[model samples]
Structure formats: C-alpha cells, structure tokens
Target: MTKDLLMWDETLFRDPEVFEIDYVPEQFNHRETQMRELAFQIRPGARGGRPLNTICRGLPGTGKTTSVRKLFAEIEAETKKLVPVYVNCEIDNTKFAVFAQIYRKLSGHLPPASGTSFKQVFDAIARILQKEEIVLLVTLDDANYLLYENEINRVLYALLRSHESYPGTRIGVIAIISDMNVDLSREVDPRVASVFRPTEIYFPPYSADEARHILTERVMSGLYPGVLSDAMLDLVVEQTMKSGDLRVGLDLLKRAALNAEKDARKKIEEDDICLAYQVSKYLHLSFTLRTLKDEEKVLLKTIADMSSEGKEMNAGEVYTHAKEVMKIGYTRFYEIVKKLDAMRLINLDYRQGRGRTRVITLRYEPQRVLDLLA
Candidate 1:
C-alpha cells in the first residue's frame, strides 16, 4: 500500500521563522571577530560619547546586517543614553527620509509627510539629541544605495558634522556596504571625508566548514528532527558555497523540506535539494537585479543579448549597442559597466590588446539573465 500523503495541517518546520531572510539567529557563529570589532567601535556611544563611525564591507549574506542588528539589540538592552536606529537605505535613500527615520525613532512619531523642509527636520533631530543628552547611532544598511543616488555626501555631512552647526550633538554612523568593489574612502566628498572616517570591518565570505556548521544549526532549530538527512545537508552546503552565500543554503533547506513534505516524506532526499538549488542559487542575483536602475537594467540586457552570440564583447562594442537602447554617452556607459561589475552581475576585465581594451562578459547564463529581466 502507498504511504499516506502529508495532510494540509502537517508541516516539517518546527519554527519556520528561523528560515526567513531577516531572522537573526540566537547563536551567530563564525563572525565573532567582526562582532567584537563592531562592539569596540560602538562602545563609546554606550558611555554618552559619539560612537566611532564604522564601514562594514562584505559580499551579500556575510552576516554584516545580522551582526549590526545583534549589536543594536545588545546596546538597547544595556543602555538608555545611546539610541540605535537602523535605516535601510534601499527604502530611505534621501537625506530628508533618513533624518525623518531618525526623527521618528527619537520622537516616537513620524514628522509631517509634507511642509517640512530638510533643515526643519535636521534642526528638530539635533534639538532632541542635545536636549536628551542621548548619543545617536545610525546604521545605514545597504548604504551603497545612498552613494548611487548622490545622497551619501549630504547624509554623511549632516550626521558627521552636525556638531559644527548645533553644539553638543553626539551622532555616529555605521555604513554597511555589500559591494566589496566599492572603496568608501574614495566615494565621499573631501569635507565629509575628514569627519566621516570610519573603522573598516570586513566580513569575508564564510569558509565551507563554517557554512556547513551554520546551516546545520539552522536545520536543527528550524526544522523537525529527521526531516533532512546528513547527506542532503552536505548537498545544501555545497550548493551554498558554490554560490558564496549563506542565505542560499537557508533557502535551499527550507525549499527542500517543502519538496519532501509535498511528497509526504518525513526526510529530504537528493532530488529535493537538486530541485531547490535550481531556484535558491540565484537568490543573490535576483536581489541585486531588483536594485538596479532602469538604465542599468537596460544596459545589462543589452550585454546579455550581445553575448548570446557566444563572443566576449569589448567596451567599445558594448557602448555602441547600449547607446541605441539608452541615450547615454560612452562615458556613462563605461560607468554603468563598472557598476555592474562591482555588483557582480558581469565580469569586467582589461586586456593588453591595443592600449588596454576592456572586456565585458555576463556572470550568469545569458538566457537566465534574459528570463529574469523579462
């Protein structure tokens, strides 16, 4: 007789939230060095002084955000003098919107949606900090978004140099940059750079063993016992390391469990993992693409289309094709190519042929990129 299928009410997850993208695990392993360094930099804020500014550089899923969140939680639990605010720059990319987040965090309400100038918001936040004697520590998660929008200088200038305009205002910033190619020091304005100097903390990609240990921990906490076999766990880790992202492992685990459940099986099998990886491996690519501007997306598509002919296109050839779809000049096209390379969407290489020609190539399968763009 056939085994009974999983009922609608049956689930393999013990705590499904543990597999979520934003879930901060209780045991954050393999990042102790980064956490300690971050804490040391932020220690001053706990004692009513401005926290040292920090720049967290790492690839996607390298525990940077989780480290900041974990530290922020510890800070809030330990002190009243320091107020920690985490602003996702992807959502709040403007100077006004950033300060508005600060305002909301301090005052327990948002500023008026209209009729409030940036100066007004800045002054209000400054007054609150000065009056309360509270040290403000803001974490600009995904801060590269601010740099792209040309608001990094304005945001950093106001936060780092606020004391010049309003005496006794203590503020610090933690800028998290996921793009390892970006040099934060070279990207900011000189005046802002002078004060915005930060303690650079690098969170390198996890080693294979570390990735295995972390994923095993997640499986134990997130799923029921006997749901995933040892062999399948190794498969998930291998795929995750291949992608160089831990989130892909977590996603693969969750998806594989679901696939098992769909088959009314208590344990995940190799087929489950193989199928889940088909989608999980591209998690980082999908997220990075979502943040690209229209022009950037168009340029990427153009490259993908050109590369489908099975030849690596040089910079000049790419610009010629890109300009037809977008009204950008060669200089701007070159910039976009560099940005895409930084984002890991494409490979940018310089060849010694004819005065250092730039070679462009897509990182993923051209058809996969085209399908996603569609």
Candidate 2:
C-alpha cells in the first residue's frame, strides 16, 4: 500500500472525534484576572446577601461566557447558599421568555405567559423564597439581543422594581454586551440605567504575544509534539486574530491538526495550516450568509456580483442594481440594504465631514457566495 494512498483515504475524514475541541481555560489562557474577579462577585453568599450583578463586555470568544460559567459553577457548589441561574438571551430573547426562564430557575416550573401577571410571578417567587430563604443570582449571557429588542428594560426593570412586592428578596442582572462602553441611556430609562452601572468588566483581545502563549498552550495540551512547527502555529494564530475572535484561533488549530491526520500524516505541517485558513474562511462566510434574511441575502448577492464585475458602486448604486438584479422595488430594496449595512455584510465608504454618499464595498467575493450556496 502506497503511503500517499493511505494518506488520501476517506476514513480519516470520517472520524467523528476530529470534530470536537476542548474549550477548557487550562487549554486556553490569557484572561486570568478578569476570570478571578468575576468568580469573586457571585461566589460569596452565606445564606443571605446582595445578589451580585456584573456586566461582562468584550468581543466574542474573549472568554466572556467561559469565565462567567466558571464563576457560576464555583458559586453553585455551595448548595442552598445562593441560587445561581444563567440564561442565554440570544436563544431566549423575549421579555416573557427571559422572565419565564428566571421563573423556572427559581420555581422549577415553566408557566405560560397568558393569564399570568408579572405581579403574580413575583408573588409566587416571594412565597417560595421566603420559605426557602435563598439568594437568587441570574446571569444573562449575550444580553445585548434583549436590550436591542427593547424587552430588557421591561423585564429587568420589573424584576428590579419587584423589591416593592417582596421587601427582603433580591434580584440582580449580569448583562453581557459586545461593545465595551456603549451608553444604554440613549435607549433605556435613566433610572433603570443607573442601577446597572455598579460593576463592569471589559475583556480585551489578547496581545499578539499573549495570543501566541494561548496558541502554544492549546497546541501542547491538545496535539502531539513536533506536530506543529513554530511557523505553522504563528500562521494559525495570526489568521485567528484577523477575525478578532479566539474561537477562530482554537478552531483553526483543531482543523489543521485533523487535516494533517487525514493525510496519514503524523506531524501536522505548515501546508495543513494553509488549508485550515481556506476552510475557516469558507466556514465563517457560510455562517455569515446563513444568518441573513432573504431580502438581505439578495442585497449581498447583488453587491458581491457587482464587485466581481469590477464596479465600484455606492449604496445608492447597489440598491439601484438590486432592482435590476432581483426585480425588487426601490422602497423595500433600501430597507434591506440598510439592514445589510447594519449587520456588516456590506461596507460603506463615508467621508468624515460629509453625509453617507453611495460608495460601498461588498464584504465578500462573489465566487465565495456561489461556493457556499452550492
């Protein structure tokens, strides 16, 4: 059997284990103090105390969720000390749904929204909490989605105000936002916004040197020795940082190792890192495309096609072209185009002192869209 034939066999591609990556912080480092302070806030409650509300702000994969979860686990260990609840707002973003989650965490029941007043929910929680005497701490992850929907203040404001109903019970919010220092008062009530201002922790991206340490830590723990050359590791880490996300770093490394292993290669080489970059780009673009609406997709595709055709079009030109390409009218087309810009699927060219003129750039190559759609 030729080595190349064994290397090219499909069996290695079918290995299910290759798809999984360990997300533990030991394999991932460079955010230690941020993790420790977060752990300190929620882990201390000797039967009764103020529930700690911490806002964790950072770009995605700066270990925000991981650090928060780690802290939650440490706090949860003291059974019956302080009740810890973690809700992902991205998945359960509605006011009723988030409140319902809080209700379930505290009451162990999922009551329907109909015929149930917020007062009723609080009364029930008060009765239960007075009986059990537990401090309820809730962590809302990816909380910006809820705030964006305007449901945050409604639900959170109600809960915070619920002290009016149950004088002794405590409820606090831990909101996570992608932006570090964005002012929410522009959108939220001044009173409600002030209550959320106590403690804010920002997680910045690792420095290039720190990123290298993180990359090395993962490589040493997860891969065989000599599998990755210094050059290969640097390339993987470099490409990962280009996305401004660390999951990309970890994912690129994992994919490159699997690519090497697939080729019947014991030692992953630089070639595998290059292949992983292409694969990661394809995956990121595919993810971005999948999240777009049909109208948004049409706008993006129209822009991508124009860019492929070497036309330097502005926002107005793009919308004008969308009418010809997708047969959509001007009114709806402009709305879809704005959404695409907001989502960052398209880039706009604007002068500092001037208004938003038409010049814009398609964020992806047209052939990439075709490959993904195929």
Candidate 2, pairs of clashing residues = 314-358, 314-359, 315-358
Give TM per candidate.
0.88, 0.74
lDDT of 1 by residue, 258-370 (tens): 89888887778899999999989888888778878889899999999998999979999999888788899887887788878866889999899669998999999999899
List the global CA lDDT of all models: 0.90, 0.69
Prediction 2 global C-alpha lDDT? 0.69
Best by lDDT: 1
Top candidate, metric TM-score: 1
Candidate 2 displacement at residue 242 in angstroms? 3.3
RMSD value for candidate 2: 4.8
Superposed Cα deviation of residue 231, candidate 1 (Å): 1.5
What are the runs in model 1 whose C-alpha is more than 4 Å off? 1-4, 108-116, 314-334, 349-359
* Worst-scoring 10-residue span by lDDT in model 2: 13-22
